[model samples]
Target: MAGQKGDPVMVDERRFTSFADGETSLELHGLTFENGTDALAVYGNGVFTRDAAGRAALAAVVDVLRRAVAALDEAGPAAQALPDGDGRGDGATSVANPFG
Candidate 1:
């Protein structure tokens, strides 16, 4: 997200990719601000269970996401997300959580 390093940006696309081994490892893919510029990836180690600390961190993150979703309904990606360039604002969302 080098181009998005300055101003606050949003994800335009997101999905998850998993390994064929069915292990507890997965990837989170996100295209930020615009397509073909930069990306954001979050990896989760399924092999490792979440400790108290990890759970706490995840809880905090979820809380913030909740707040942002409530506050930035028209702005933030999570609240009003749509597929890249679709531009319909149809409130459709794609989730690829193989972890679950």
Candidate 2:
């Protein structure tokens, strides 16, 4: 976990993979911005085997995500707003079909 120490990790946008699983009830994706950067998004509940290593790994993932969120917060509201285009070129600001 690169953000374990509360430091923001600069992850490349190209490494993202769209993921969804009904069994685990979880989804992971990368929301790309018009500026060509992407943000990782994890949604819904997650299930993992109960074990010490699993716990530690989950903690690390949480730490990294927290750091990323904190960094975004520090960037202020302008940085938080969605970039232009919305990837559809229809001038839509909100998500049209998130599950698709």
Candidate 3:
């Protein structure tokens, strides 16, 4: 989107259209779970503009998101490994003991 220098930048909004055919795929027995995904295509017919700083900032944001996602993935297994406090595991001992 472009306009006079003094004018506010207005992004030319375009409606998104999607077409999908019925398809099915089987999942493998074991795979690391990844939660989110994005697919984007930016193209224009006649003219285009590039903003290096803006692109760099966008990349930085994506990197931050990836790290955040990795941290969440790492936390999930640890959380699952912990006992659920119903006194059902060998991981943690009960509070009533002979050491009193």
TM-score against truth, every candidate? 0.27, 0.38, 0.27
Candidate 3 residues 1-100, lDDT tens each?
A: 1121212111134211111111211111121112222211222232212577656544533343344334334556663664455433235556877777
Candidate 2 lDDT trough over 10 residues, lowest sum: 16-25
* C-alpha lDDT of residue 5 in model 1: 14
The predicted structure with the larger TM-score, 2 or 3, is 2
Model 1 spans > 4 angstroms off: 1-49, 73-100
**Ranked candidates (TM-score, high to low):** 2, 3, 1
The candidate 1 region of ten consecutive residues with least summed lDDT is 28-37
Model 1, span 1-100: residue lDDT tens: 1112122222234222211122222221221111111222233432323688666545533443343333334445653563464333334477799899
Candidate 3's clash total is 0
RMSD of each: 13.1, 10.4, 18.9
CA error at residue 20 for candidate 3, angstroms:
40
Clashing pairs in 3: none
Which of the numbered candidates is closest to the native, going by highest TM-score?
A: 2
- Give the better candidate number (1 or 3) by lDDT: 1
Residue 49 of model 3, lDDT score: 25
Clashing residue pairs in candidate 1 are 24-46
lDDT of 3: 0.31
